[model samples]
Target: MNDLSRGLAYTFATGLLWGGVGVFYSKGTEKKESFYGFMFLSALLFFLLTWIFAFPQGAPVREVLLVAALMFPAGLSGQLGFWTMKKALEHGPHGIGWCIVQSSMICPFLAGVLFFGDSPSAGRIAGMSLIAASLLPLSAQGVPAVREDSCSGRFLLLIFAAFLLVGLQQTLSLVPSQCPTLSAAALSWRVPLVSLVGLGWLGPVLFRKTGVRCGEIGWISLLYALLVFLGQLGIYRAIDFLGKARSSGTAYPAACGMSILFFFVYCFFKRRERLSRRALAGIGLSMAGMFLLAIS
Candidate 1:
């Protein structure tokens, strides 16, 4: 349809892909299927596919080379983030990890405003404050009110780190300003982050935990990879079809909303994670900020 509609659709789709990551890991039907393993493989596939599809029409050779070279960082980030995320999943409930990681959205929003000169509205600012406020209770350093196991502060820290990287990845979206024509430049800024997921292998390697079967895991990882590839492509297409402002306005907020919705429904029903008044308020506040940011 129109640019705004397209942007909104793409952004929402990205969130759906991102939010479903945990679901994919959960559906592995085997404890041996580590989230890190899935994340690492998925990211590698996504990046490779991105390169293939992006360059098929005779993209700039120099830019592609540079983009490929820069992919190292995105890979690195992904590896680390995935490790943290996987650990969080193992240590915490399914959807709670998603909520925790999302707590760091402020990082990118700030960066966007500072580096990209994207101004947030007053409503957005207030919503952000509420989001930050909502998180205060979670910082108390105790086992979450309800869970399979006690969530340690260490896990919280890891989740926060994940959030930071996600934010950084979003900020990396600004890399195109320096090298706009090179599709690689835009994608490269985040490739290392995805690559960081490889670090998860350390667990299986070091701890001697039984790893996922090669054949069984391949298809799952491939699906994840393909979804991620299409999601990023959609985002890039949104940026192309709709200018950054309108695109971000529609997409970012919609993505957050969708992810949050998934988290709430799944955590309450499937995983049965306990939700406190504070957590609900936080979710609301964060969503409000996201909506404001979109309109802003």
Candidate 2:
């Protein structure tokens, strides 16, 4: 396949895999399963896989240290983001929570412009505006009349926390790729290092006597780890094929947009998540914003 085709294929696969991740997360929440335990297991499994297959060889000490420094915060932010997202999903509408999480591409986009000297355009500005506007209706959807005030407030706070933490994680993940001194070999080890760091954060929970057994969710956690690993692999390959700048502009939006669509479909069919008129309008605006961001 041509480079563009390869990039598109990888992007599409990443979207599908990430969409599956969200679906599984929602399922685990619905079942009142130990999502943290599942995450801990998945992180261990992911680390093992990356160590075996993607570990770098003979990398410079400085570059390895750089990857460690960046990925430490990235891993911590990612775990914190997952925690908030789990809370948000448990209390709020599935579509709304997932949509906000997927829309976090805006964070890195803005970071690129503000910190990395990426030029912003009119379309991107408008796109960001629409995304911001969409949150109004999305937040409203989370605050139905049947729910208590405290519950509503908690849900909104969790949602906002998820958005910020996930965005920060994504922004941090982008930095290693942008660094000019890092080689592909040096960067290859980042996946394993990040997974290792995530395991550190989950260590207390995983080591507790009352912790959920791996056998309880073994197959599911395995699937989750596989999906996450493959999704990251797809993202890296897409960037390689399309280049950092082009991939940042195109691949991220395509993956996120497709994941949102997939989540909506899953919610509609399986969870019976019917959207209010306002929610539908918000989704429309968010999709339009993603499109504009992609082209900009």
Candidate 3:
């Protein structure tokens, strides 16, 4: 298949995998303890396994520590956002939850410009416009009523925060590609592992133990870890085939958009949430903005 086709295919597959993530996270809520507990344990195990292969033979302790340190922020933000997202999903409409959670992308883009001096282009401008267009309606008025027990206002904040974290993660993406000495996989694993371990240390001291004891929860966590790993693999593969432009612009968002749409459709069909006329408009605009952002 051609580069475009391969990128498109990867995007679609990524969406499907993410769709499964929503379902899995929702199921996880039924378990007993806090979402972070499960996240921590699962992350720890995954990191342990990844480290076994990821740590180079006889690598310097200092270098290993440095890689681990890099992971701290990424993992903490991600897991925290995830826990918040899961809670929100349980109480909110799945479609809406997914849609809002992605607002995290905006922050990183802005950060890129500020920190890395990455300038925007016409396509980037148009794509960002589209994404912004999609959000206008959603934010114009009050959202549809969410469950009292669900994520609601706090959850929305978490989603926004999560997107920012994702943006930072994106900026960090330059490290591996630019450095060339550290492989992407090694960087990827280290980043997350650091964050998780940091959170595992901090979570309990700050808050009550939110441990969930459900056996099924373990399964969901495993699936989440695996999907994330696979998604990263797909990203690299797309980059190899399509280069950065296609991979970042068309490929990543296309996949993410489809994933977002899938949740929206599922929520609509299930009658879990009503898509306001405003939301529809916002979604369109958001897509435009995303396209603009990517190409820019």
Model 3, position 270, has a per-residue lDDT of: 60
Better of 2 and 3 by lDDT: 2
Off by over 4 Å in 3: 1-12, 30-34, 48-69, 86-94, 111-119, 139-159, 180-212, 236-255, 286-296
Error of 3 at 121 (Å): 3.0
Candidate 1's C-alpha lDDT? 0.56
User: What's each prediction's TM-score?
Assistant: 0.74, 0.85, 0.69
Model 1 lDDT, residue 272, Cα: 67
lDDT of 2 by residue, 21-96 (tens): 8887776666454666777787888888778877767788889899889988988888888878888766767777
Clashes found in each candidate (C-alpha, N, C closer than 3 A): 21, 0, 35
lDDT scores in order? 0.56, 0.73, 0.55
Rank order (by TM-score, best first): 2, 1, 3
- What's the C-alpha lDDT at position 141 in model 2? 62
Comparing 2 and 3 by TM-score, which wins? Answer: 2
Q: Write the per-residue lDDT of candidate 1 for residues 1-296, one digit (tens) a residue.
A: 76666666677677777666555655542345454455455656765776566544444667655654545454455456655676666666555666666655566556545655555667666656665665554333212454535377767777778877765554454344334566634444343333344545556544655554556578887876776666666655554443444224334444655566565666667766666766666666656655654554
